[model samples]
Target: MSKLTQLFKKAQSNYDNYLKRDNVDGLEETIKAFEKISQSELNATLKKATLTELQNCNEVLFLIAKSYTAYAFAKQKELSYTDAVDSLTKANQCYQDITNYIAKIPPFSLPLDLGRQNTEAEFYKHKMKFEQAKMEQFFIKHKMTGAYDAEKAYEALQNIATAYSTFQRVLEKSYKYISYKIDFGINDELTNSIKDELSEARTLLAQAKNKKSKRRADETPTSKKNDNGNTQKKRRLRQRVIIEEESEQIESLSSINHSKEEEDTYEIPASEQEKRQATSESLPTAMELSQSQPVPLQGLDLLSTLAMSFFAPPQNVSSPLPRMSSTLENSITAQPQLENTNVFWNQNSTHIKDSQECNRLLNEWSLIYFNSLSTPVSEKDNQALTLERLGHALLLAAARLQKESQFFGQQKINPALRIAVQLLSRSAELSTKHFNPELTMKELSAQYAPLLKAFANPGRQLYNLEYLQHLRRQVYKESLLINTREASVTDIVTASFKALANTCFGKDYEIVRDTCFEALLSATYALSKNNHI
Candidate 1:
């Protein structure tokens, strides 16, 4: 082999070695060393070189260009636009120099190869792409002043959208693309992540545009959350804002049957949910629901910020109860989105056990998370899953309201009571089809009976006589489903009276507390004709 081929062989070895580097520091060092082979670095030598030397310079530039591409791809993983821009710029410079000093290159034998696109046209295509990535990175670097940028956020999103659309095409075309994946494994996941972020950014930006005239911009919570070392609280709250699905849900409850009117009315007030199967454009916002009037689009700036957190890496949720030590989290006046819960929420006022405070903090997060949905939960959507998840948040709020509800001074009606019942009842409904564990069924039955008992009153508009009668029938059916297989007459009677709590007490449905006693007696009789109590 000629000396020229031997030098090229060594250059090829250096190229493969440099491309093998993964870390930022190692890649940087490789980039620096390989940069010596870049056009400008070789310009002085090239001007005085022989034909063989010029050919060698061309090969060296080719090797360096590929190394630069590898370095750029590695830096892109760090999500640092400055680094991406810097590395890709070096790469494009090398490729540009290769075409400038056009020559008949020797057979390609480099271990590290980008496969196709060896032509001048291909080089220019990739260089343009590198430029596109730089522009996109700039847009990301300047992402609208967090969610507070509000209306101003539209411009940043617009820039990101343009660049995102172009680069998406660039990534899919090159299967061997280094930037697509770190180790060149699956690229779809990362690509989809970019798509998802762009989609959410667009959605938020569109909403911002529509409300720009009416909605005032605010600052981001990123600083406030970091204040007073309340970063952990911020994380717990951030997780809730996601568009919740079954896999990501809390525990669920078994539900009973209800009338069509009840079904229409059965919604966790202020809980916003979007239909799982609905299209992006066609999906309705939860605010459109007559019952789910979440904080308006004006507060969506916060939603815009919170929405971005969903794209973040999976984080460990503080086990069970979560504490809110930060003033930003505890301030009710600051969070205008939630209903004033001074009656049920006591930890906010008085010093309490850490557990109680944590419960309240979780309550706050739940309200905020549901409110953040901004979109409508589809009627076709199975609300059972959402209600089950919500029930977990409402218990503390529910228990407090149920207690203070007996006293005259704090007779102030709290929405938590109704909302809690709505969640529990909806999740418990037998008609409400869900795949959640059947284990929580008995627990739901126990909780649902009392909540309905507390909520039942003659004059309340929501629980009118007609609805109570329907509910009484539902109770009778639920009891039959629960207690018919009794071993003894005493067991049957004991279970019957226990089931009576579920029936509305003030009125009679079938002459004797909805004839529940008679129905149980008849059921026990049918089980054994000779046994009568």
Candidate 2:
């Protein structure tokens, strides 16, 4: 017999032994033995093993790859997600190459672990399963804090939905053609996970569309507000017109209303007129006035008086932040009056560079924004852009620190992440997009994603993950993890009652009643279990 046939037979024997132990699906030995055979030079010699033997080897590889994918789902093992995904990817790629290698081989009696022959439907099922796992991994890793923007999220979800449809077709075909045994639970799991990340991704996509539509609607064909080329001229022109109109109206109103004596009292002075003209010449071109010109002792008061004059400002009124539309600041929340946000922009990142240079290029912008966080989002004309940019800066900084752990030793974890949650939350209110990239390959290891999502789009969204408890499902798991203590069972019971008694049952509270109560009940039971009886 050829060396290839001998090796394939030996690997088949090992896989046979493993299956006898009641693992109908191939497991540890099946993977190792077939993997060695695949790496061998004999695998390239198609004539070494009979056509039937080659098909059997391919079936074994498919089963192994399927097991690896299930392992990645956290349905198996407590290890980091890196190991799981790598195994799945390697197995998936290997199976794909080998399948192509034997593509010319005709369908035959490829015996299965189920005492029946494998069919073409089996191949289709394996392909769909692998694709679904990959999409899930992608969605989890890139859902919030990474370079995975709304479009990526939307596409990944669509792919997941496609998998769901494929599985349904696979089951129906299997039944119709008497193919390999298909499990009903396959449909259940697909329906559950693919629900295409379900409403969350769709909601983000919808909100993104709305933001774009609103932006386009707000655009004026006459004015170039979105133009970065000549914002200074626009600002200067707007101020000049406002000042001139105010001066003219005041002079005309006084000309009709006042007598000669009264006219003396209201008469415009030459110095004042010159000052108004000069002020008209300069109304603090965007925020550049803060950096270039020294504010006089009462410049803020003077500027405020200049700004709030005469005409009620329209929705598209000019703002002090360069190239940022004032309409974008419609519902800005006040900046958190915290210590880090006071001046230097610490955990909060409230301060930034005092110039327009940061927006010139992506790399330079990233650098400047990363190094300096001296700007407040609330004060920006485009508060949404400011918030998203600052959040991205923090996310980038966190990712760097994570990468630098080898040389820098352990780093503080939550400060940047916590602040980023706040920023992204406000940004999502204005525009439902988090323009960041993957922090890590692992799905759950990227915890910042859930926190960011929960903050940004949180409003009574149901999270049905059985793995995480109430604290993590509906709230920040980080804070709950800290200072956890063993309280008496009675204490937990009493606390629950006290909470219920004190809480008001208004319409806003109604939205979260079930979510909060589930959390409370689960927390109480868990604490009771962890504590002394």
> What TM-scores do the predictions have?
0.28, 0.30
Name the best candidate (by lDDT): 1
lDDT of prediction 2: 0.34
Give the Å shift of residue 438 in candidate 1: 66
How far does residue 236 in candidate 2 sit from its true spot (Å)? 17
Candidate 2 has a TM-score of 0.30
Which stretches of model 1 miss by more than 4 angstroms? 1-25, 35-41, 44-59, 72-83, 103-124, 127-153, 167-533
Estimate, for each residue in 1-533, the C-alpha lDDT of model 2 and write its tens digit: 43333333333333333323334233444444444554455356544556555544444444444444433443223333334434455554544444454444443432221111122323433443434444343434433443334333333333333334333443443333211222112334444654545344445545434443445445413322333444567778767666766676676555446334333432211110001111111122112223232212121122223222311233432211100000011111111221111232133221122111122222333333333445533322244444455445444433443344342224433333443444444343343232111111112224335433323222223233211122122223122211111222223223322222223122322222333333334433454455432
Give the local distance difference test score of model 1. Answer: 0.36
RMSD of 1: 32.7
What are the per-model C-alpha RMSD values against the true structure?
32.7, 33.0
Best by TM-score: 2
